[model samples]
Target: MRNTFLKASFMAAMASIGAGEAGAADYRKNPFTLAYDGAITQNEPGKVNIHPVTYKLNGLDIAANVYIPANYDPKQAYPTVVVAHPNGGVKEQVAGLYAQRLAEQGYITITADAAYQGASAGQPRSTDKPAYRIEDIHGMADFISQYAGVDRKRLGLLGICGGGGYSLAAAQTDKRFKSVATISMFNSGRVRRNGYNDSQLNSVQQRLQQASEARAQEAAGAAVLYSGDANLSDEQIAKLPFELYRQGYEYYWKTHAHPNSTFKYTTSSLLDLMRFDATDQIALIGQPLLMIAGSEADSLYMTEDAFAKASGAHDKELFIIEGATHIETYWVPKYVDAAIGKLSAFYGKTL
Candidate 1:
């Protein structure tokens, strides 16, 4: 019965995006657009002139778009940006967008799909285990060093959405990332545990109950239901919890939907995220931190709160771009350029 619910929920989540080729966003301008053969197995990056590499991380076949700066040399070193993805996202998604743009700005960038979420490997597809999530960043650091052109000493991190929180996770514990920055970041563990700004506290416990029941099913070898489906009629969609959430569907589904992409989240993942508090660990980090977010971004406050809570950061600051939404910062030039330029200066100074 739980497996039935999982399938029912999964299909409903897939359909929720109102997904279909004829739906919209045919320009396919993002970096991942170049890799849509739908191979769940590892595939190579197309165009954008990246050197694609496939490697093993914890036995997972990790694929990355490795862009070495034009001035790169085996003897001479260069800075590297280890890019990570948003929740329920693949490397070929928005994270790759950031990676490509950053690489173009003369940094070595490697964007790898997260375990189980994209071309990367893990059984029980789409599971969002927190340990694995944090490990993925550490794994990337180890994975990229083998390249001859990279400066292991000048490593940096750029995470988008949930990736932002994970970047903090990796940075707080691992000293290898000399500098760290985020775009449209989310305190996934905090937000999932206690909604945005704790506003949903009234019902957060009940939602936890529901998620727990779903996880019980998963432990029994049954598939789990996903959260955050976008399916709704015009009126019902308007009733979404937040304005940007509604816009998320417009971006991820109507405007940006690839038949290959999905928003389905693990039913058990919530339990993991609720406990995966990156901010709680931030004080352990000694690197300089650059936390950037959209002024209008619904998730902005978390960045602010994190900045307040971090005690050990050598240097840290938050910049909120005016008139931008969360997803806008993900791709918009006004938002992204602000981020890229600021980050370049930050890393240039710190790393």
Candidate 2:
């Protein structure tokens, strides 16, 4: 029965891909187009209003979007959630999708582009260090807690993909978040250090040396070296090894192509990413935790691993979206709805 369900879901998804081809072509001209279902094209008069915001974080201006719930009133305090975007994603993509959905559920939500990436201000852009990413989460907490209608004590957090991993790290020490949740969590540290599923274990030392050299070049004020910097043809992208990488390219490059969304990162960033582990201090997070992932996702292992190590969150729950892959959870309506449903229930109870 489960196998049959999986097959049906896969077929439906493929069918939708065929139907989306024309729409994808329409979006090809604009790189910053928000192509997801229920995207906020323009803020309605009385409906949810999306406010573009910027705040200082570690001396850099961080770009973010705050979604004000329908019929919002500043006089009444409201619960708020800070959303963290995926790697190579911006404030207007999946992160914005979830934030808008959460706002529809009556929570004021804020989604921010990571500092040094996606419309945010920083020098030597696309620097993907884990510490800076974690600090971005902390910075979001600081800014949103003081927003007009926010009740700081009623704060919750929801992170997707790479942001999920950083959110776990930030929540480990920052108790300002009363509740924590993640969707399709990507363990950036593990993947950077040992390849996806440890496939590149043999090349760890070589990669470390490469990263060290990249750092040395940066220190000497030479040109910055970037990893995963490639502009692949349609044929080349189609032939990528993993579904995560292949679908990721389709999502970021073809479907929801954003000019600021690139997979490249400063090569030296790996020096920090390789040594950091989201699960290293997982036991320190005492807030209620909800970690959601697709059951069929190759990245499910990371979510399971992190959840297993989350010993301090006695109220934790691992929810799996059946028959969905990692990237599918980012946009597929059924899978995303399942995730949002679970998230609403979790935050409704915990926040």
lDDT of 1 by residue, 1-351 (tens): 334533654465456554554334332443434322221222234323466677888888776677655445558777889998887666655676677676666778888877766566566667777788888899889988778778899999988888888898888888889999988878888877788667777877888888899889888977667886445666775787886677776666655554435666687788787777878768897889888888898878888888888789868888889999888886666777888889889878876
> In candidate 2, which residue pairs get closer than 3 Å at backbone N, Cα or C atoms, i.e. clash?
none
Of candidate 2, the 10-residue stretch with the lowest lDDT total is: 23-32
TM-score leader: 2
**What are the per-model C-alpha RMSD values against the true structure?**
5.0, 8.5
lDDT of 2 at 282: 91
Give the Cα-based TM-score of candidate 2 against the true structure: 0.91
Q: What would the per-residue lDDT of candidate 2 be over residues 85-198, giving only the tens digit for each residue?
A: 999888878998899899999999998889888778786778999999999999999999889999898999998999999999999999999999999999999999999987
Residue 16 shift from truth in candidate 1, angstroms? 8.2
In candidate 2, which residue ranges exceed 4 Å CA deviation? Answer: 1-33
lDDT of each structure? Answer: 0.73, 0.87
